[model samples]
Target: MEDVVLIYHNELGLAFRWKNTVPNADYERIQVVFRNMSFYLLQEEISKFSQNIRSAQFYNCSDCKANKSCRNILLKTPLEKMDISLNMQELSKLSDLVEGTLFKLDLQDYIWGAGRN
Candidate 1:
């Protein structure tokens, strides 16, 4: 928590993403470690950021090659709509809430998941 607070206050320019370490480059589904703490803190940070962010897109694309855009400042845009379907999978069941917000499937399985304004 302290680390997140420090980063949020001192280094607001950085957005932290937590993922498990991939091992054995030759293996397909290698066991990876999860950073649960950072994930939790990121959830909180997203909630806070959502309170004010009107136009933004977030995504994860592991299959991407090495030369992908790393930050929002480097992205091409018309200053209105943002496309983030690169690392996202097509979901089958996501007709419950607002559109344009599903990453893989509607995570509605989690109690009162992220819907609503």
Candidate 2:
């Protein structure tokens, strides 16, 4: 399954839509390949697939360094739209994250007056 995905990306550059018709195990393997790929390669793949990634969504992904790191990485990309649905504490850091990127951001699921910001 992983080989199939890698070959597809190498040949088609994400131009074709991928159907999630496989089992969770296959998905997990494919995810590992994605994780190991460089940010430049990933960006190229995304651009080749969609021309541009205009939007992104994050949900319940706090409390994990890897997840937060992924979010931070996305902020550095040429993204025009984003939605971050983490806790209030994390929201305070959004300004730093979304800096330099002109994006339409949506903050959600954060508690009011949660001693953040």
Candidate 3:
């Protein structure tokens, strides 16, 4: 958290960016650092990821031999090579995090009249 400007966060994960970094070209991007993985995604990509997570299904793994609970959900990201696995509670938190981030971004846009630009 010290190295990045936190956009939104919860116990599950966060979206952030390195301090003082400027947009390379046009669109701005943020780093979604969650659990053991991280991704640099645009605002549209984040919205798509949030939609995918919301529409995902949860199930119990009948053949799971692991001692931990077998109930989990797998969500595909906007990226082709990455996916996320989460239990019910974790899924909820992640949803909150992403949705909150989107809300914050929208608010910032409104306050700054970004849409009129």
Per-model TM values vs. the true structure: 0.20, 0.17, 0.75
By TM-score, the best candidate is 3
Clashing pairs in 3: none
Ranking according to TM-score, highest score first:
3, 1, 2
User: In angstroms, what RMSD does candidate 3 have relative to the true structure?
Assistant: 3.9
Q: Report every candidate's CA lDDT.
A: 0.25, 0.29, 0.77
List ranges where model 2 is wrong by over 4 Å.
1-83, 100-117
Q: Write the per-residue lDDT of candidate 1 for residues 1-117, one digit (tens) a residue.
A: 222211121111222222334233222111111211112222333333233232233434456665444332222222234322221211111111112122212343243465643
Q: On a 0 to 100 scale, what is the lDDT of residue 20 in model 3?
A: 59
lDDT of 3 at 51: 90
Rank all candidate structures by their lDDT, best first, as comma-separated numbers.
3, 2, 1
Candidate 3, residue 36: lDDT:
80
Better of 2 and 3 by lDDT: 3
lDDT of 3: 0.77
Candidate 2 residue pairs in backbone clash = none
